[model samples]
Target: MSTAFDILVALGGLACAGIALVAGNRIGSVAAFVIMGFFVALAWVRLGAPDVALAEAAIGAGLTGALLLRSANRLGPVREAGVPIAVHGIAACLSLALAGGIVWAFATGTAEAVYPSLVAARVGESGVSNPVTAVLLNFRAWDTLLEVAVLVVALLLVSGLAPVRIAPAPPSELVLPFLRIVVPVAVLLAGHLLWKGATAPGGAFQAAALLTGGGLALALCGLLGAGRRTGHVLVLAGLGGLALFLAAALGAAILTGGLLDYPAGSAKVWIIAIESALTLSIAAMLVSLFLGPSEGVRDDR
Candidate 1:
């Protein structure tokens, strides 16, 4: 009694996985990976998780594919014949064996749902109906907070590598008009997602991804350019979320006697505020990553 959607999802998964394995070149592998991401997104929707699907389609497939393609362009085309046959064989065998073992374990394992009581007990206090949102933003806020820090640090390290130097060139007129319309719309959408995340599936990660996409669109179209200096404002933007969260948490200790202990009256507001800041910081960090050390020509038409 599988629905058509379920059948399509299953077929898509098999197709993507099979293509990934059989692909002989780097380009083919990249293509397969992108398709796999799309299929994964569909699977997420089939499993009744729209937020995960959106994130998968945006960041997992869209941004990841762009990064891979950009890297490949810089590295030049792969020379298949130049690779050693013995090395390829060894790599293939090892990969296949590892994948097989993982599959076997999952197939044989008795799955047990643990920790439901804990989640159910805390759900009401978390200020959200969605259990996943509750766990992500309230129960496990520290993890999410630190993850934002990690993304910021990674961007800073990349920026420090070569200094930012944007090429001086005018982007095509054709690209500008499209960006002008799209960027504002993207910003509005990101804000909406961030706000809705409290009770719904949308959240900081999805908002950040859309915001990142908008920034990237601007950079790609030559509307925004990188320079030698990582301005104090940009640096602050990167650390702002973590700073705000820490400050708020520590400030609450004076009133509540514990760090990160929001006053009972406005816990939801505080969490939402922190998530908004996180969305901004995460978006900026992701955009900076694509911009790299900053010496590159990006033409959009």
Candidate 2:
């Protein structure tokens, strides 16, 4: 039964991707892509990685779909340029090469995968029972730090693009009431996820994604942006996470003679502090990217 269900999911995902690739309607293609993301997320969950599934659903499907919808709105239903035969041939060749490489690796590689065992043995020392959290905050923190840096860089790139503001429409009677309940719930869930991450399947990225969703909702509803001061503060918050992480690295170097190393018996405190700061910065950066730099943030930055 499980195998059959998995097969059904795989086929459904493939169908969605095919539709997205071939659909003439821009809005329809975006919707298909978003559904594909959900299918992929479900696959991840079935594979026992709920963290990855949550991140995929929230960031990949929800936010990315929203961005594409916004872009489609601005660009209208214009036809994209046709691809050349030579380009298609080149892409096909690349796909074939990738598949051959994967097959070759599986046929030739015989070594046992030891990473799970290794993580299990050492996760206790990392101040988090969740192996994913342990690796992100302790065992292999450099990668996560670099990921944070990448988000900041991406935000800066987005800032260079012109803002795409939606034309104001008549306020819906249900919009305010909907936000009143959902925004607070999102905030509460985000905080819960942040705290629960030490032992369970939640973390900064997932929590920040929730926060970004709520912020985007508010912005869309015209309840968010007000003055230059608020914009400036948002910009600062967007940059604050990386700054805090760098400072923490320097402090860790002083205390433990290595970058990002927590002091003895205090790893939890360090991880929680860093994660909390990162959550806010990441959410701020995402919101700023979507809204673009307002007058206050643009001039200051």
Candidate 3:
């Protein structure tokens, strides 16, 4: 059964990718790519990497699909110019060469497993029993910090470019009730994921994505306030996580003589703190990215 499921997932992912590549409609192509992301995420789960699956689902499928749809809407339809056969041939050759290189490297790579064993042996020292969390927050936190920096850069670039305001939905009888119930549930779920990251398959990225979804929901429903000044404030606040993470890293370095080297038994504290701050910052940054750079005018609720 497991083997069959794996085969199905592999086939599904390939089909989706091919469909996306060949689809004439922009929206259709984006939809296929989004489905492919889900299939790829499922494959990650089947490969025993739920964390990767979560990231893929949230960033790859969910947020990326939103961006693509927006871009597609903005672009509308354009007349396509036929590509030369020589150009297509060159592209195909390059792709085949890349695939062959990957296969060759894998076939020649050493079988000796080093990092997994090392990570397992030192999981206790990292203060998180979850190996993935340990590596991300303690064992190699500087790498995670750099990932946040990338998001910050993206936010900066987006702030400069995306200034158009999306008009909020007109007030409806169902909107408030919906927000009242769903928003709280989302908050609880986000918190649950944040707390679970220390010991389970949830973390800051996953939780942040959930919160961003909720924020978008509220914004669309005309319950959340947004403007250029508000966007500026949110962006400023988004740096809070980066600051907290760096402070933790530096504090750890002061105590342990190495960067991100948490002092004995206190790693969990730093991880939780960093993850919490990160959850909020990431959500804020995403919301600002989507609803930001507006004029001084507020959308009518």
In terms of TM-score, which candidate is strongest? 2
Q: What would the per-residue lDDT of candidate 1 be over residues 49-154, giving only the tens digit for each residue?
A: 8989988998898888877766655565666667688998998899999999999998998877566678988788877766777777777877776777787778
Candidate 3 lDDT trough over 10 residues, lowest sum: 292-301
**Model 1 lDDT, full chain set:** 0.77
Candidate 3, residues 1-301, lDDT tens digits: the string is: 9999999999999999999988999999999999999999999999999989998999789988877886676664856886788998999999999999999989999788899999989998887888999888887888999999998888888766765666686869978898898888988999998899888898999999889889888887767775557667778878788888888888878998988887787778878989999999999888777775454353322
Question: Order the candidates by lDDT, highest first — what do you get?
Answer: 2, 3, 1
Poorly placed runs, candidate 3 (over 4 Å): 82-85, 108-110, 293-301
Candidate 1 matches the true fold with a TM-score of 0.82
Model 1 per-residue lDDT at 98: 100
* Poorly placed runs, candidate 2 (over 4 Å): 167-170, 295-301
How far residue 237's Cα lies from its native spot in candidate 3, in Å, is 2.1
What is the overall TM-score of model 2 with all chains considered together?
A: 0.93
RMSD of each: 4.0, 2.9, 3.0
- What Cα-based lDDT does every candidate model obtain? 0.77, 0.87, 0.85
- Measured against the true structure, the TM-scores of the candidates, in listed sequence, are 0.82, 0.93, 0.91
Write one digit per residue (lDDT tens) for candidate 2, span 8-55: 888989999999988989899999999999999999999999999999
